[model samples]
Target: MGSHEAKPKVLILGKVDFAHDAWNALTQICDVLNPASTTREDFVKECQSGKFDGVVAAYRTFHSFGITGLIDQELVGAFPPSLRYLASCGAGYDQIDIDACSARNPPLLVSNVPTAVDDATADVNMFLILGALRNFNAGMHSLREGKWRGRPALGHDPQGKTLGILGMGGIGRNLKKKAEAFGMKVIYHNRRQLSEELSGGAQYVTFDELLSTSDVLSLNLPLNNNTRHIIGKPEFAKMKDGVVVVNTARGAVMDEAALVDALDSGKVFSAGLDVFEEEPKIHPGLIGNQNVLLVPHMGTWTIETLIAMEEWAMENVKLAITTGKLKSPVPEQVDLQ
Candidate 1:
């Protein structure tokens, strides 16, 4: 179809460009609108004036918090009266207010790309684990600043280390395979333990046991009410001293302030984080800390994975508009039905 042909009106609220083919596919199917290179205030104003049939809540789109907060809730309410479906490009929609959407008169159908992101997210989990254990942040900084760590002030190895995975989802399972290849033993705590075959012989333990036995702790869970600040001061105290912390999950999953405190007390030897509680804004204390390795929220951001996610999200959008059903709605949305 030509660009001028009638198509579902979609608001592309992406902070970053989509994979080229993904963008092409979207353009071929939807009439997309993007707010200019604008201020958050201006964007919020535009969002609040929503007039599109569907809204593409891109990886980082958000409504203002509360009455005027930017991000989920605010944007959810911003949907035009004609709105039918809202699809977020990423797996976790904790940033999007599913409850509010559920309460809408004819509730907006929502969806996300879940499985498509697993491989890349898992890769990043391992990257973070190794970086944290090896002190890659400090080492890289030292080298860049013209100082090498005389081979002694280096990092630890994953060999024979116990990698405790907090969430045993697809990403967690992939991380297990890779960690095992590096000679690390894996243990996990999940809401429900996987079968032995699914777990590939990785031990399953209670949360407390996972903490005590883990030499390196990796967080791969979602962010929700129960999961918010799940790893706080008390949880930190329970962990083995010098445990390396790696998070490819949500930032709020770990208490950033509490983590810094643990780092200060020499409890957590180091940390590698890809997501932050208040993302794009690092905790003031974490900046300039040599023990922490921080990356922007780019868990599933490789070329291949990005294309898969974008295409999956668009597929959901297409199905929702055509059949009034989503292929992969969030679990809570499924429960509601």
Candidate 2:
């Protein structure tokens, strides 16, 4: 067998879904050392030993790995001299230690499948909006309890609701289309306005205006310094009473305490959350709240997306290790390479 056919040492960090597609895609190029059912500590030790050539991190194992438990500064010491690429399975790279990786003598090429995740996330956003507006969680709970919620558990209609999107990027745009399909009027507040054509009839509104006017507010903004706690108590107070809030974005983007408070005060009618500020450690206040639906960050949790992500990640790892470049390095690292 050629050296290329020989399995290269690949380190698995945290939890990766060890499915047929994942293994087939990864194994075809390099051997996949996946210990998905194990603890995060073991993965850390493996990488730190510096014997691996490629590192793989995934999103499907969020429930097992917990929030922000993957790649971090503490685990950066494990990058063996052989390590060249740190391939992330999804677009959300908050768990990564970008600075630490960059400071290494030979910086790690961090790659994520950004484009492939948009449609899946957008589908999740619509699900959140519909689920929250329709109070699906509450109705389901009431039904399961052998009690008919009846009129008391009535859900709002999406036909005429206004959906205010905080970010108008790819995921946001896809969500707008889906929301509009349900007869919703889409409005958005982006860092900068997109061209008229790209807006797709989504009105350009100021952040405050969007907050006040939206009957359904969807948080799709990226997590960054300026966007942290973008939706808090003060912002909630400006929204339409009983507004539905859906967050498929990062948990820290909205203050969890504020969301719980708003839910209690009826400022937010219902909340469908796929991500939390302290994820896997859901806010205690949101627990048992009939108006809240919590998903363990499964916005991009579909077989198609997962397999595609794995394929892209392996391609990135192979390209980086063999050609000294990644197919899809994280945006900031693009310039560095």
CA lDDT of every candidate: 0.78, 0.77
What lDDT does candidate 1 reach at residue 122? 87
Q: What tens-digit string does per-residue lDDT give for candidate 2 at 267-330?
A: 8889999998875688889996988987888888888887677667767766765677888888
Query: What digit string (tens of lDDT, one per residue) describes model 1 on residues 221-298?
Result: 888888999999999999999989999889999899999999988899999999998878999878867889888988
Lowest-sum lDDT 10-residue window in model 2: 55-64
Show the colliding residue pairs in model 2.
48-78, 50-80
lDDT of 1 at 83: 69
Top TM-score model: 1
Task: Give the Å error, residue 309, model 2.
Answer: 2.1
Q: Per-residue lDDT for 167 in model 1?
A: 92
- In candidate 1, stretches whose alpha carbon ends up further than 4 angstroms from where it belongs are 1-7, 26-30, 33-50, 53-74, 150-154
Q: What is the C-alpha RMSD of each candidate to the true structure, in Å?
A: 3.7, 3.5
